[model samples]
Target chain A: MKLKSTAALIGSIIGASLLAATPAHAQNVKIGLLSGITGPIAAMAPPMIAASQLAVAHVNEQGGIGKGGKLEVVVGDSACNPQNATDAATKAVNIDRAVGIVGPACSGAVLAAANSVAVPAGALLITASGTSPQITSINDKDLVFRTVPSDDYQGRALARTLKGRDITKVAVAFLNNDYGKGLAEAFKAEFESLGGTIAGYSGHEGSKASYRSDLAELAKGGADTLVIFDYGDGTGLTILRQALENNFFKTFIGADGMKSDAVIRELGADNLGTFFTSSPVGEASSSLESFNKAFTAAGQSPDAIFTTTSYDAAFLMALAIEKAGGDNAKLAESLRAVSSAPGEPIMAGEWAKAKKLIAEGKDIDYKGAAGDHEFDKNGDVPGTYAFFKVSGGTYESLGEMK
Target chain B: MELIGLANYAIFMGILIGIYALLALGLNIQWGLTGLFNAGIAGFFAVGAYASAIITSPHVAGRVGGFELPIVVGWMGAIVFAGLIAWPIGKVCLRFRSDYLAIATIGVAEIIRLVIKSEDWLTGSSRGITGIPRPFGELDYVASQLAYLGLVIAAVAVVYFLLERQLKSPWGRMMRAIRDNEAAAAAMGKQIEARRLQAFIFGAAVMGLAGALFVHFNRSITPEAIDPMIATFLIWIMLILGGSGNNRGAILGAIVIWLLWSVSEMITDRLPTDVALQAKYIRIFVVGLALQLVLRFRPEGILPEEQARQTAR
Candidate 1:
C-alpha cells in the first residue's frame, strides 16, 4: 500500500513536469539512440553519440527523414550494463515513441535490448560499434542491422593473413569481456580449422594495470607469433611489448580491439611488425582530410579510429532511408540494395548520382568512410579487411587480412 | 530560465533523500541497533528488486507469480524474501568478528550478482526484464515519477518515525545495550542473538521494500542493476555523512546528494553544446572532487546523530 501510494505521488509530480513539453515533442519524428554513455565502453561510445546526433542534424538541415519536417533524437544511456540497456531500449521505443534505434555499442548491450524491444517493435537497430558474430547469427529478423562486421569476419581475415605468412602456431590471450571473448573464439576456430595450432590460450582481466604474470605464462608456451585478442591499452599492451624487450616473443597478432594508433604508440617501432585486423577504413581523400580537420577544429580527437566509421554509418543509414522513399521499413528492405561491386558506384562522392538513380528506380549501392559495405546475408558486411603494420609513428596498410 | 522554478529540484531531492532514508534506516538497524555490519547491503537490495521483478514481470515465463499484482503486495513479497534470506546469512556471519562478517557478506553480494547475471531462467540472463507495468502508468511517465516521489517520501518518513518510536521504548534500550557490549547485555538476561536477528531481519525487509519501489519506478529490472558501487557506496556514504543511528540525518544526506547530482546534470545540460560534449569527462572529475571535499569538510556529515542520554533519577 505504501509503495503504491508513493508511485502514485511520483506519477503526479512527473506528469506536471512533462505537461509543458508534450505539445512541442508531438511535432518531431523521434529516433531512439541507445548508447553506453558511461562505464566500460564509454571510451568508444560518447563520440559515436555525438556523431550520430550530428547526422540527424545534417539530415534535418537537408530535409527530414519522412513526412516529419524535423528529426529529434532521444538518447538512452545504457551505461554498458545489460539490465540498463533493456530498460533504456523499452523507454526509448515505447515511452519516447522513437521510430528506430542507432546504438547499443557493446555487443552484450545490443543482445540484452534487441530481442524483446527493438525486434518485436519492428524498429530497426543500427549499431555503430558492436562486432560480436552472435548478434547477426542470433536470427533472421532483418530488423537487427549493424554498421560493423562480425568478429568472425575480422578473425577469419586475420587467420588468412597468418596463412599468407606461413605461421603455424600462436599463443593467444584475450580480455574476458564479450568483445574480447568473441574475437578470441572466432580467431581460434578459424585459425585451427585451417590446420593451425594454438600454442596457448588464456583470459586476462582488463581493469588491472599489470599483465606481466599473464604474459609470462603465455611466454612460457614459446610460440613466436603471439596473438593478443584483448583491447591492448597502455596497461596490457605495454606489458606485451615489454615481453619482447625481455625476449619473450618477436611478432604479435592483435584483433580489432588492439587495432588502433594508441596500440602502435604504446608498442613503438621495435614491435613494428605487429599485425591487427579491423574493418577497412577506406582511402582518405582531401575531402575526408578536411572533415578530419573540421572535427579537430570542433575540439574532438579527430584521429580516434571510430569517428569516421560512425560518421559514415549515419550517412549510409540516411541514404538508405532516402532511397526507400524515406521510410524505415523501405529502408530496411533497401539495405540489401546497397551493393559494393559490379553495380552503380554509390561511394560518398557519388551521393548526388545515387540520389538521381534512386529517383530513376535504379539499385543504389552505398560506399561510405567504412569502405564499400556490401552487406551479405544476415547484415554482416562482406567488406575486405585491411591489415595495419605499425611503422614509424603511423599505420601502413601491410595488405588485406584476407 | 530562472522562472523554470525549483519544484522539480525540490521534488527530486525530496524523493532521493527518502530513498537514502530507507537504506540508512535499514543499515542503522544492522549497525546501530544490532551491532552487525553488513557491507553488502546493495546485494540484498538487488535481490529484492529481482525477486519482485520475477514475480510481477508480465514477460518472465508469462509472470507465473506475476498477475501484475498491486505494488503493495509485490513489495510485501520482496520484503519477506529479503528477511528470510537475511536470517540464514546473519546466522552464519553474526557470531564472527565484525571484519569477518563484512568480508563474508561482501562475498554473498558477489555470489548473488553472478547468479543474477548467469541464471537465464530466473533473471533473464543479461537480457534483463522490461515493460514493467508501473503502478499508475495510466497517468504516464512524468506523473508516475511525481507519484513515486511522493509515495517514497511518505513511506520513508513514516518508517523513520515508527523506528524512532520503537527505539525509544524498552526494545530501543535493549538494542543500545547490545550495541555497546553484547556479553554484558547477554549476562543481563537478554536474548542477544534473538534481538540482533529481529533488528537484522527488519532492516533487510525495509531494503526489500525499497528495492520493489525502485524497480517499479524505473519500470524495469535487470541483473546488472545490482551494481554495488552505487547501492553499497551510496548507502555507506549516506549513513556516515548523515550520522549513523540518526534517521533524520540519513534523510537529509540522501536529499542533499540527490540534489547535488540533479543540479549538476541540469547545469551541464545548459552549457554550450560543444563544451558540454567535452564536459562529460570533466563531470566525473567534478563528482570525484565533490565527494572528496564533502568527506574532508564534514567528516561527521551534515546532520550528526543525536546520542541517547538517560535522565538522572
Candidate 2:
C-alpha cells in the first residue's frame, strides 16, 4: 500500500510538471519580458514593464501581429543576477517558448542569459537598459542586442562635458559593479586623453555603513572636482552627504545613474547648486511626443529614463514579428531588417502603417520613441548625452553633448 | 528541440545542485560534526572563485591575471588559498564558543566582498574577471552543459567520499566528542583547538573547491554572483533539512532545496507580469514556511543522522 502511494505521488508530480511545461498559447505570438524585477534596480522595472505592456496593447489594438494573432508577453524576473537570469531566460525559451527576450537589464545578467539561453535557443535578445562596455565583447553570434548605447559612449561624453567646463583635474569614485567600473574607466581614459589629470580614482563597494575613509583618501588627492558614478539609491546619496559634510570637492559631477529626483530632494536645490549630471538624451521626434502624451494620458508618468526605450524595444520586437509573418526563427533577421536604414521610415505609434508597409514587402527603418536607432554590427546605437543641473528642486537640461 | 531545452535546464540545475551540495557537505563538517557555526560561506566561495579566475584567465592590460595556469593547478590553488584564509579566523575564534566563530566569519565574508569589489587590479572591479577556463566550454550547449554537470558531480562525489570516510574515522569521533563536551574532551588530553581548527579549515577548503567548480562552470565570477546572507542562510537550511551530521543527507538536501527554488521560479514565471513581480517574494516566503514546517515536524531532518551502531555488518 505504501509503495503504491509513493508511486502515485511521483506520477502525479510528473504529470503536473509536464502539464505546466506545455504552453497553452494556441494563437498568440509570445515575447519574453525579462528585467530586474526585485533587485537593486527594482524601482526602474515597474515603469519599463508598464511601458512594454502599453506597446503590446497598442500592437494588439492595431489588429494584432500577422493575421489577427494577439501578442502575449511572458514576464520573467532577472533580479539582475547571472544564474537567476539564465534560469528565467531558459524558462521563457523552453516552456513559454518566447520568440524574443526583451531584457535582463543588468550587464552581467545580459551576458550570462545571452550566452547560455537566448543564443542557444536561437532567440533574439534586446536589453532595454544595460550599459556596460564588457557587454560589447560577448561572443553571442549577433543574437544579443541592446537599445541603449554602452558606457563607452557615456564615459566619453562625460569626460568631454568635464573638459568643456575647463575642469582639468578630478577625483573619481565609483560603485564596484559592471556599470560603475566600466563607466569610471571609460571616463578616466577619455578625461586623461583630453589633457585632464586624474588626481585619484577608486572603486567603492556599495551598501556600506560608511565610506568616510575612502572619501577622505579621494579628498586628500585635492582634486577640484569629484566624479561619482553610481546608482541614485541610498549609497550614492550617503557618499554625497559624507563628502558634503567633509567639504571635500568644490564641484560634484555624476552620470545617468546619479540623475535622480531623490538626490535633488534629499540634497536640496540650494546645496545642489554646484552639482551636475548627465543622462542619455532622447531626441525630439514625433514618435517620442506621441509616446509621452499617450503614456501620460494612461495615468503613468513618462519621466522615468528608460520608459521610452522599453516601449521602443517592445514596439520594435512586435514590428519584427509582424515583418517575419509571425515566424519566431526569422525574428532575428527581421529585427535588423526593420531597425536599419534603406527602408521606409516607420515612426513610433505608427504600428498600423508599419503593418501595412511590412505586408507590402518594403523595408522599414524604425525611428524609436527614444530616438534614431541605427544599430552597428555590435548591436549598439550611437546616442547623445544631455547635461542636467538642479534648478528649483528639479533638473533643467543645460544642452546636449556633441 | 523542446526536450533538448529541458535537458539543458536539468543539466544546468544539476550542476548548481552539485556545487551547493559541496557547500552543504563543508558546513556539515563545521556545524554538524565539529559544532562550529559559519555564517560566511559566500566569502570563502568568493575567495576560491577569484583565486581560480585570476590563475586561469589570460592576462589583460590593467588587471592582475595573465599567467593562464593549467585549470587543474588553479583549482588546487583555489582549495589551498581558501583553506589558508580560513586558518587564522579558525585559530582566533576556536578558543571561544561557536557564536564568536559565526560573528567573525560574517565579518570576514564582508571584508572579502569589499576586497573583491574595491581591489580593481586583483578583481576587475565591477566588470569582474571573465573568460575563466572551463574544461568543456567549447562544446555545443547541451554537450558542454552535460560535461560541466559531470565534472561538478564528480567533485561532489569526491568530497562526499572523503567526508564520509572522515566521519567514520577516529578523528571524526573525537571531533564530535569535543563538540558535544568541550570540557570532557579537553580533560581527555585531546588538543580541542587544533582539531576544531583543522575541521574548520578542511571544511572551508571543500567550499573553496566548490567555488572553483562554480566559476569554471559559469565562465566568470562577479561580486553579485551570490547574496551572502540569503545564500548562507539557504545552505544552513539545506544542511539542517538534510540532516547535518550525515553526508548523504547534505547532498540530498542540496538537490531538494535547489529543485524547490527553481520549480517555484517556473511557477511564478507563468503568472501575469504584475503578479509575477510580486510572486518572487512570495516564493521566498514559501521557502521560509517550508523550513518552519520541517523544523516543527521533523527537526532531525528528512534524512536523520544514523547513530553509530556496535553490530557488525
Q: After superposition, which runs of candidate 1 have C-alpha atoms over 4 Å from their true positions?
A: A1-38, A46-78, A82-99, A111-124, A132-144, A156-165, A274-303, A320-345, A349-363, A371-384, B1-37, B42-177, B180-184, B191-227, B237-267, B281-313
Local accuracy of candidate 1 as per-residue lDDT tens digits, A1-402: 999999999887777766754445225556677677766667777667766665666667654544444666666666675545655576566555666777777766676566545664566677777676657753437877776777766777777778778999888887655566666777888889999988888776567766677777887877887887766553446656666767777777776567666766766755666554454555434435544654666567655645666666666666666666645566567666754455576654344566567667877666665666666667766545777776677766676665
For candidate 2, give the lDDT of residue B88: 89
How would the docking of model 1 be graded?
incorrect
lDDT of each: 0.67, 0.83
DockQ scores for all predicted structures: 0.10, 0.43
TM-score on alpha carbons, each prediction:
0.69, 0.91
DockQ-based class of model 2: acceptable
Q: State which candidate has the highest lDDT.
A: 2
By TM-score, the best candidate is: 2
Question: Any runs in candidate 2 off by more than 4 Å, and if so which?
Answer: A1-26, A208-217, A220-224, A241-249, A326-329, B1-4, B308-313
